[model samples]
Target chain A: MGRLRPGHLVEAGFWLGLCLFLYVYSFEFDKNIEIYKFGASGWPRAIILLMAIAAIGQLIHHYVKGDETSSQIISAAVDDGSEEAAHAAHHETVKWYLSTFALLAIPFIYMRVPEWIAGTSEPGDAGLHTARLIVAAILIAVVVYFIRHHRVRVMLMLPLFFAALLEDFGFYALAPFFIIGVMYLFGERRPRPMVLIMALIFGFMLTMFVKILYVGLPVGNIEPFYSIGSWVVTVLQ
Target chain B: MDAFNNFLQGSITLFSDPINILIFLGGVIGGMLFGAIPGVSMLTLAAILLPFTAHLSAEQGIMLFSVMYCTGVYGGAITAILFNIPGAPENAPTAFDGYPMTKNGQAGKAVGAAVMCSALGGVVSTIIMMAATAPIADWAISAFGPPEIFALVFFGLAVAASVGAKTFWKGWLSILIGLMIAVVGLDPVGGIERYDFDMPYLLAGIHFIPTILGFFAVSEIFVQAEKKVRGSYKAPKLSVDFPSLSELFAHKFAVIRSIVIGFFCGILPGIGATLAAFMGYNEAVRWSKTPEEFGKGKLEGVISSETANNAATGAAMIPLLALGLPGGALTAMMVGVFQMHDMQPGPLVFLTSADLVWVVFAAMFYANCSILLIGFLETKTIINLLRIPFQFLAPLILLLATVGAYAVRGLTIDIVVMFLAGVVGFFLRRSGYSIAGIVLGLILGKIGEQTFAQAMQMLHFEWSGFFDRPIALGLLIAGFLTLCGSIYGAFFKKAKTPQTPDPDSA
Candidate 1:
C-alpha cells in the first residue's frame, strides 16, 4: 500500500472525529415529547448513523484515491515549480491568507461590537447592529492595508471608509463621498461627470426611498442630517 | 364567455383607479429592483412591503402584492445574465447559460431572450391559473398529504444525481451535510430542540435566505478576490446584442415544455420556483437536439430555466387562492397580506371576493406586461454592470449581501453565519461539490423531515403504511427511479474523449 500524505490522514481524522461528535450529540436530543411516536432523538440518531456510514465511505475513497493518484500528482506539480514560480506562489498564499483574515475578522468585530456598546450578553444587539456594520467596514480597510499589496489595499480603503461613515452622515451626507471614493479607487481623475451622476443618484435615492417610500434611512447620527431628514419627510408628506 | 367578462370587469377595475395603477407600478419596479440586486430576495422585499399594504383597500393591497410576486421572479434574471452572480437562487441556472453568453459579448441577446421567455412563461401561466385554478386546486388538494409531501421532497433530492458534479459521491455527501444542518433546530413533530448546543439563535433554526446569500453572493465575492490575487481577472464588455426575432421563435417548444413543468411543480405544496427552474432546465437538456451546447451558452438553456421559474409565479397562486395553502414562502406571505385585509383565501374566498380575485388575475397580467416594458428599459443599464471594474463591484456586492443577510432576521448572527457559509461554500465549489445540490438539500430537508415525521405519527410509526397511500407510493417509486438513473449515469456512462468536455459536466 502506498503511504498516505499527512494532509489526507488529517482529513480522515477530522471526519472521523466529526462523526463521533455527532454520534455523541445525538444522545443528548430530548425524547419526551408525547406527540412524536419515536421521540425527537430517534430521527437524529438515524441521521447520525447515516452520517457515520458516509464518513467511513469518505475515508475509504480518500485512502484509495490518495494511493492511486494524489501523491504522484503532487510530486509532479512540486517538481515543475521554478524558484520564481515558488516565490510567486508564496506571495499568492500570503494574499489568500490576508483576504481570509479580513473576511473572518470583520464578522467577528461586527458581532462583538453590540455587546461592547450596550453591555448586553447578546453579541449583536439591535441598538448597535447597523453601527457595527460601518465599524466593521472601516476595520476591514485598516486590516487589509497591513497585509495586502499596497495598490489593492489603497483601493479598498476609501470605499470602506466612506461606507463606515454612511450611518453617521446619512444619504445626503454620504452619497457624493461614496461616489468620489469609488471614482478615486478606480483611478478616475476626471471627476466632473462623476460628480454630476452622483448628484442625480443622491437626488433619486432621496426622492424615491426617503420621500416616496418612507424607508427608515438613518437620518445621520448628527444634527444637519436630522434636520435634512426632517425637511425631506415634512415636505414630502 | 362569463369568465371573459369577469376578466374584462377586473381589468377595468384595476386600470380605472389611478392609485391601483400606482400600486401595481410600485410593486413591479420595487420587486424588480429588489430581485436584481444581490442579496435582496423576492420574499424579503415582499415581507418588508407587506406591512405597508395593510392601509390600502383590499383590492389595492392584493394588487400590490400580486404585481410584486410576478415581477420579483422576473427581475433576478437580469443580474444573473450580466454577472454570473445570481440575484436569487432560482436564477443560478440562468447564469450558467446567460453569463457565458455575456462572456461571448451577447449579453443583450441573452437578457432579451430571458425577458421574452420569462414574460411568455408568466403570461401563459397566468392565463392557465385564471382558467384552471379550480381543477388544478382540486387535484392538488386530493393528491398531497404528509406522506406525499415527504415523497416529493425525496424525489427533489434525486436532482443531486443530475447536477453534473465531478463526483456523484461528493454531491451525495454535500446533500447529507445540508440535511444534517437542516435538522439542527427543533424537531417539527416533538417540538424538542435537536442540535442547538444551547444557543438561542440555533433554537430558531438556520434561515435559508441568509444561507443562500452566503452560498451564491458571498462565495462569488471570495472567488473574485482570489482571482484578483492571481491577476487573471478581466472585465467583460457591457454592450448587449439583442436576439433576432427568429431566435426567439426557435425555442418555442422548449418554452412551452418548461412552462408546463414549472406550473405543475409550482402547484405542489412546498415546492417553489427553484425546483421548477432546475427540473425545467434538466428537461430541456433531456430533449434538446444540441444538449452539448447547454452550459456553454445555449439560448434554450436560458429560456427553459427563466420560463419555468416565472411560470411558477402564476401557478403558485393556484394553491393559495384555491385551497388557502401557500404554494411557497412568497405566497405564504401573500396569505398574511390577505388576512390583514380581513380576507381569507381558499374556496370561500372566490365566492366572497370574486371580483377581487379577478382583479388579482388582471394585476398579474399587468405585472407581466410591466416586466417586458421595464425589463427592456433596464437591460441597457443593467448590462453596464460588466463595465465596472470587478474589484470595485466585488465590494459593492459584499455590502449588499451583508445588508441582505441582516435584513432577513435583523440578527447580526445571520451576517456572521452568512460569511461562514461563504467560506465553506468557496471550498465546496473548488472541490467540485455541487453547490446547487447542497442548497437544494438545505431547502428541502426541513420540509421533508417535518412531513415524514407527520406521516409516521399519522400511521402510528408503521413504516410499511407509507406504501398504503397510492400517491405516496407512486412518488416513492419515482424517487427510486430517479436515484437509479443517476447511479447508472454516474458509473455506466461512457468516458469522454480526452479533448472533449462531457455534455453533462458542470
Candidate 2:
C-alpha cells in the first residue's frame, strides 16, 4: 500500500531468521520422555512456531503500512508529545550507529578478553593474574586518554570495561575513575566540583553497598588496588 | 471478619517494632525519591535492593517492597506537575494536565490535587486488596488445576502482548522472545535440557533479576544517553499550593471512577499502573461534561491519573499474591524475593505465610497514608534531587545495575547477561516492542510449561481434556478471542482507515 522502509524489512528479517533458527534448534531436545505425552521440545517448539507466525505477521504489517516508524508508534503509546520522543524519532547518524555497535560489543569484550589473555592457562594462575593486571592498566590508560575526545563511544564502552577489570582492579580503584570518566563525558568539566561530587558519591556507595548491605563487592586480586579495597572495608568496619 | 482481625493484628505487629517502623519510613522515603528521579524507574531501585532483602526478615523485606510500591507510584506526580518530565512512565499522563497547569501558574494546586488523590486512591485500593486477596487465593487454589492455570497464563500472556506495542504483532513477538528466553534452561517437566547448549550456567536457567536490571535499568540508561546526546530539558521552579478540601470534593466522581478503573486494571495479570493511569485519564475525559477542558490544565486530569496509578499499586499485588502472576516488572522482582526467601507466591502463600501477606497489606496501607503528609511536606525537597543531571545519574545507575546483576548469583556471566539484555532491550524498545510483555512472558512461560505437563499427565495425554474443564475452556476461549480481536484491530480495522503519508517518509 505504501513504500516500505529498508529498516522495517531488515528488522522483520532479523526476527524471522532468529525464530527459524530457534525452531530448528528445538528439534535437538530429547523427544522420548516416558512420563509426558508432550516431550521436552514440545513447549519450545510451540513458542518458536508462535514467534515465527508473529514475525511473518509483522512482515505483512510492514509491507502494508510501510511509512509508520517505530518511534511514532512509541510516541503514540507514550502519548506525551514530548521533545524527547521527537528527537529520538530523528534519523540516526553514523556516530549513533558506531556508538551502538560499541555498546553491543561490551558483553563480548567482557567474556572474551580474559579468555584471550589466559590462553591455555589454568584459572587463578599467578602469572595470568599479573598479565591481566598489566593489560588492564594499559587499557585503562588508553580509555582515560581517549574518553575526552570520544565521550559517547568511550562512555558506552565503559561498563563492560569496568565489569571486566572490576575483580582485578577492585571497586575502590576503578569506581572513582568510572565516575569521573562518566561525569566528564556528561560535560562536567570543572575539576574541583567533579572530584568533590565523585568523592561524595563514592563515599555514599562504599557506606551503603559494601558496609551496610555486605554486598561482597570485588576487592581486587592484584596488589595496591586489592590493599586499597581491603583498607577501605577495614576502616568502615 | 477473619481478614479484618488479621489486618489489625498485622498493623499491631508492624507498628510494635521500632526497627520495622524505621524500615517502613525508609522504604516510603526511598521509594518516593527513586521514583521521582527522571531516567530511573522504581524497578531499578527494587532490583538493586533485591539482593539485600535476603538478609532481612521475610516480613520486613516484603513489607518494604509493598511500601515502595505505593509511594513509587505516587512519587512521579511531583516531577510531572512541575517539570513536565514524568519520573516514571505511569506518571506520563499526569504531565498532560499537570504541566499545563504549571504553565498557567497553578502548579501548587496541580501538585496538591495529585498528592491527595494519589493517597486516596492508594488507601481505597489497599482496603479492597485486603478484602479481596484471601478469597481470590482460596478460590484460585481450589478451582484452578493445572489445565485451568495454563489457560489463565495463556490469557494473561495474550492480553499482555496486545497492550503497549504499536502493532499487535510486535507485542506478541516480544512475548514470544521472552518465552524463548524462559525456555533456555532444563525443561521444567522433564529433566531434559532444551537450550542449555552444554553450558553449566545455562543449566540453572537465566535469572530474571539480571535480565530485568538490563532491560529496565541499563537499556533505559542507553535510551536516556541517546536523548542527552540529542538535547535536554531545563529544571523547573519549586513551589506547591495545595487545593482546599472543597475544591477536591468537587471532583469526587472522577476520583471514584479512576479508583475502580485502576483496581480492575491492576487485578489483570500483565497490565500495570501505566495503563491504568492512561485508562483513568481517558475515562475522565469521556465522562466529563466539557471534555475539551482536559489536557488544558484541568485539575480532574491530574486527579484521575495520579489517583488511578497509585490505586493500581495496591490492586496490582492481588494477582501477584494470589496467583503468582506479577502485574508488572516490579512484582516480577517480588517473585524473585519470594523465591529467595524460600517461599512460593501463589495460593499456598496464603496458608503458609499469611502473616507476611497481612504485613504487606498493613505496610501498603500505612505507606499510602504517609504519602499525603510526606508529599505535602517534602514535594519541594524531593524535587531538588531532579536537579542532578541525567549524565551523572546514568553512570551511577549503570554501576548500581552492575552490582545488582552480579550480586544476585555471584556470577560474572550474569553481568554479561545484563549488558547483553540491555543492548537488546534498547533495540527492542526502539522497535516498539513491549518490555513488560517479554518480562511477563518469561515469568509466565515457566509456570505455563510446568502446568501444561501436569495437566497432560492428569488427562492421560488426551489433548481434548482441556475442553472438558469448563474454567480451562472458558479461559482458552477468552485468550483466543483476545488474539482475534487484536488481529482484526491491527490488520483489518487499520486497513479500513484512510492512510496518510508519514512526514518522515519523505
Candidate 3:
C-alpha cells in the first residue's frame, strides 16, 4: 500500500479532533435516569461516533484500495503539469490556508476582544480562556508564517480586516475604503476609474438602502461620522 | 375555473400595484445582470436581495424572488452564448454550440435563439407548475404524516448521491457535516442547547441566509480571486436577430421535447437545470438527422439547452412548493426565504397562503415576458457586460456577501460567520466534495429532526412504528434503495471508471 496523502492525514486529524470534542462535551449533559431514550447529548454523540468511524473507514479505504479521489480532482481541475499550473496550484493552497487561518482568527478575536478589553477572563472559565488563547496564538503564528513567506496578499486580509473594523468604523465609513483596498489588490493601476466606480456604486447603495428603503446600518461610534449618519437619516425622513 | 380565477387574481394584484410592477421589472433585469456575470449567480443576487424583501408584503416578497429565480436562468445563458463562459453551471451546455455560432458571426442569432427558447421553456414550465401545484399539494396534504414526511426527507438526503461528486462518499460526508452543523443549536423536544459552546449566537442555530451567502457568494469570491481574470474579450458587434415565427415553429418538436425533459428532470431531486440542459441537448442530438451540425453552430442546440435549463426552473418548484423538499440548491435557498417570511413550505401553505402561491405563479409568467423584451433589446449591451474584470467584481461580491450576512439580523457576528462558512465551503469544493449535498442537508436537517421527533412522539418511541404506516413504509423502502444504489454506484461502479468533467453532470 502507498503512503497516505497529506489530505488524508489532515481530514483524519480534523475528524478525530472533532470526535474528541464531541465526546468530552457530551459528558456535560446529565442523562435523565428516568427515561430510556437518548437525551440531548445522545444524538450528537451518535453522530460524532459515526463520523469518526467514517473517517477511519476513509483512511483504511485509502490504504487498502489506494484511493485517489482528491488528487484526481486536483489534476482534473488544474489539467496541466505546466509551470503556470503548478504555480497556480501552489497559490491556491496558500489561499486555502490563508482562508482557514483568517476564518479562525477573525471570529475568535471578534468574540473575545470585547471581553479581553474589559479584562473579563476569570478562573472559573479558565479552560475556555485557555482554549481561546491557544486559538489566538495559532492564528498569530499562521499570520507570521504568511508574512515571512511573503504569501499574504492584501485581498486575502480584506474580509478579516473589514470584520475587525466594521463595528467601530460603521458601514458608511468602511465600505468605500474596503472597495478601494479591493480595487488595489485586484491590480487596478488607474485611480480615476476606481474612484468613479466606487462613488457610483456606493452612492446608489446609500440612497437606495439608507435614504429610500430605510435599512439600518452601523453608524460610526466616533464623533463626526455619527453626526453625519444621523443627519442623513433625518434628511432622508 | 376557480384555479384560473385565482391565477388571474394573482396577476391582477401584481399588475395593479405600480411598486409591484417596478419590483418585478427590477428583479428580472437585475437577475439577468447578476446571472450574466461570471462568478456572480442568481443565488448570490437572491440571497443579497432577500433581507431587503423582508420590508415588502408577503405577496410582493414572493413575487420579487420568484421573478429573480425565473430570469436568473436566462441571464446565465447570455454569457454562455457570448463569451463561452457560463454565468451559471446549468448554462454551461449552451457554450458548446453558442461559442461556435459566435465564431461563425451568428452571435446575434445565437443570443436571440437562446433568449427565445429560454422564455419558451420557462413559460411552459410555469404553466405546468400552475396546473400541477394545487393537485399535487392536495395529494401531499392527504398523503403525508410525520413518518411519511421523515421518509420524504430521508429520500431528499439520499438524492445527494446523484450530485455528481468525484466520489459519493465525499458527498455523503459533506451532508453529514451539514447535518452536524444543523444540530448545533437547541435540541427540539426539551430545548436543551447542544453545541453553542456558551455563545449567544448559537441559540437559534446557524442562520440560513448567512450560511447561503457564505457558501455560494463568498466562496465564489475566493475562487474568482485565486484565478487570473482577464478583463478583455474579442467579440462580434451584437444585434438581435430574433428567429422568425416560422423559424421557431421549425424547431417546435425539439423545444417541446426539451420542455418535457426539463420539467421532469426538475421534479426529480438533486438532478437540476444543468442536467436538464444536457439531457435536452443529448436528446436533440440523438434525434437529429444532421447530428454533425450540433457542435458546429446549430440553432437547435441552443434552443434545446436554453429551453431545458429555464424549463427546469419552474418544474423544480413543484417539489419545493408541494413537498417542502427543495429539488436543488436554488430552491433550497428559497426554502430559507419561506422560513424568513414565517411560512412553512408544504401543502398547507397553499391553503394558508393562496395569494402568495398564485403571485409566484404570475411573477414567473411576467418574468419570462420581461426576459423576452429585455434580452432582445439589450443583446448589444449585454455583450459589453462581460468586460467587468473579476478583480472589481470579486470585491463587490465580498462586500455584498458581508452586508447581506450582516443585514439578516444586523449583526457583525453573522458577518464573521458568513466568512467562516465561506472558507469552509471553499475548502469543501476544492477537496471534491459536492456543495449541493451539504446545502441540501443543511436546509432539510431541521425539518428532518422535527419530523422525526414528532414521529417518535406519535409512535410512542417505538422504532418499528416507522414501518407500520404504509405510505411511510413505501417511502422508507424507496429511500433505502436510493441510498444503497448510490453507495454501490459511488464505490463499485464509478471507482474503477475515471470520468471526465461533464457540465451537464455538474
Residue A156 of model 3: what lDDT? 47
Among these predicted structures, which one has the highest TM-score?
Answer: 2
Over B142-200, each residue of candidate 3 has an lDDT whose tens digit, in order, gives 88888988888877676654454445566567777777888888887777787788889
Q: What is the interface RMSD of each candidate, in Å?
A: 9.0, 4.5, 4.9
lDDT winner, 2 or 3: 2
> With candidate 3 superimposed using the best TM-score fit, by how many Å does residue A116's alpha carbon deviate from the native?
4.5
Tens digit per residue, CA lDDT, model 1, A1-237: 334565456555766687688878877885677777678877666766766665565455555554222210111111111222323434335465466445455435544664576566442355555555456557656644553344333333333343334444554555556555544444445668567655665566556555666555544554566577666666765
Per-residue accuracy of model 2 over B353-393 as CA lDDT, tens digit each: 88899989999999999999998888878867778777668
Best first by DockQ, ranked = 2, 3, 1
Better of 1 and 3 by lDDT: 3
Binned by DockQ into CAPRI classes (incorrect, acceptable, medium, high), candidate 1 is incorrect
Which is superior by TM-score, 1 or 2? 2
What is the C-alpha RMSD, rounded to one decimal, of candidate 3?
5.3
lDDT ranking from best candidate downward = 2, 3, 1
lDDT of 1 by residue, B375-485 (tens): 778777654543545444444445455545554454556656766677676656544455555665665577668788889888888979987898788878987886676
